[model samples]
Target: MTTYFTKDHEYLRVEGDTATVGITDYAQSQLGDVVFVELPAVGQSFKQGAEAAVVESVKAASDVYAPVSGEVVAVNDKLPDNPATINEDPEGAGWFMKIRLADKGELDKLMDEAAYKAMVG
Candidate 1:
């Protein structure tokens, strides 16, 4: 599995044709404690770079974008009740959604772990 990241601080773990997406650990730290999460509805379609979900924290509201174009197949409903889950595990249990890639080529636009690290640093 290869994990791709975006400049906006989103992370994507691709496994076969599906990808799990979420905000990065750095993002949660910068946002402070998350308070509410607006998840995309299942079946919703988004283009790469399109804003799909909204994460509201004690500090600010951040848009979670689509790192690759796809249809939202599932969401972490646990977030609505306990948004802090993101801060606790931004890359694991904190995953926001699963998307069925609209076009595999879209993944090319995202950054690799190394590039993402440099971007955050």
Candidate 2:
């Protein structure tokens, strides 16, 4: 699997045609204690850079953008009942959704781990 990131701080873990989506660890840290997450429904299509989800924290509400254009296949249902999981594991059990990629080329436009690390720094 390969992972890519958007400048908006969302990550996409691609494995085959589907990719798992989530906000980055840096984003969760910046948000300061997640209170809720409004996730996209399965089968919903979105363009790259479009808002795919909404996360609310004690500090403020933030949008999680799509790192690539695709149709959502599934979403984590654990979030609404336990939003704090995002703060504890933003990249793992906290993943927001999975999407069937529309354009593989869009992944190339995103940041690699090194580039993302530098940008976050």
Candidate 3:
């Protein structure tokens, strides 16, 4: 799997044509104790950079944007009831959605781990 990151701090773990999407560890840290996540429905489509989910935390609510355009294939059902998982494992079990990519070329616009780290730094 190839992982790509957005400037907004979202991540896409791509495997073939599908990708798992989530907020980054840095983003969850910034949010400070996630309390809720409003996820996209399966089969729903989104454009690159569009609002795909909403994450609410003790600090504030933030939009989790679609790092690349795609149709939602799955969503993490565990998030609403166990939102703190976002803080504990933001990039693993804390993933928000899986999407069938609309265009793989869109990934070229994103950052790799190194570029992302430097940008965030």
Cα lDDT of model 2 by residue, 1-121, tens digit = 9888888988889999999999899999999999989999889999988988999999899888887888999999989899999999999999999999999988888898999999999
Query: Residue 62, candidate 1: how far off, in angstroms?
Result: 1.2
Q: What's the distance in Å from true for residue 8, model 2? A: 0.6
Kindly list the per-residue Cα lDDT of model 1 for residues 1-121, writing each as its tens digit: 9999988999999999999999999999999999999999999999998999999998788888888999999999888898889999999999999999989988898899999999888
What lDDT is obtained when candidate 1 is compared to the true structure?
A: 0.92
lDDT of 3: 0.94
TM-score of each: 0.97, 0.97, 0.98
Model 1 stretches with alpha carbons more than 4 Å out: none
Error of 2 at 24 (Å): 0.7
Model 1, TM vs. native? 0.97
In model 2, where do residues sit more than 4 Å from their true spots?
none
Superposition TM-score, candidate 2 onto the true structure: 0.97
**Reference-based lDDT, residue 84, model 3:** 97
Using lDDT, give the best candidate's number: 3
Error of 1 at 96 (Å): 0.4
Worst 10 residues of 3 by lDDT: 59-68
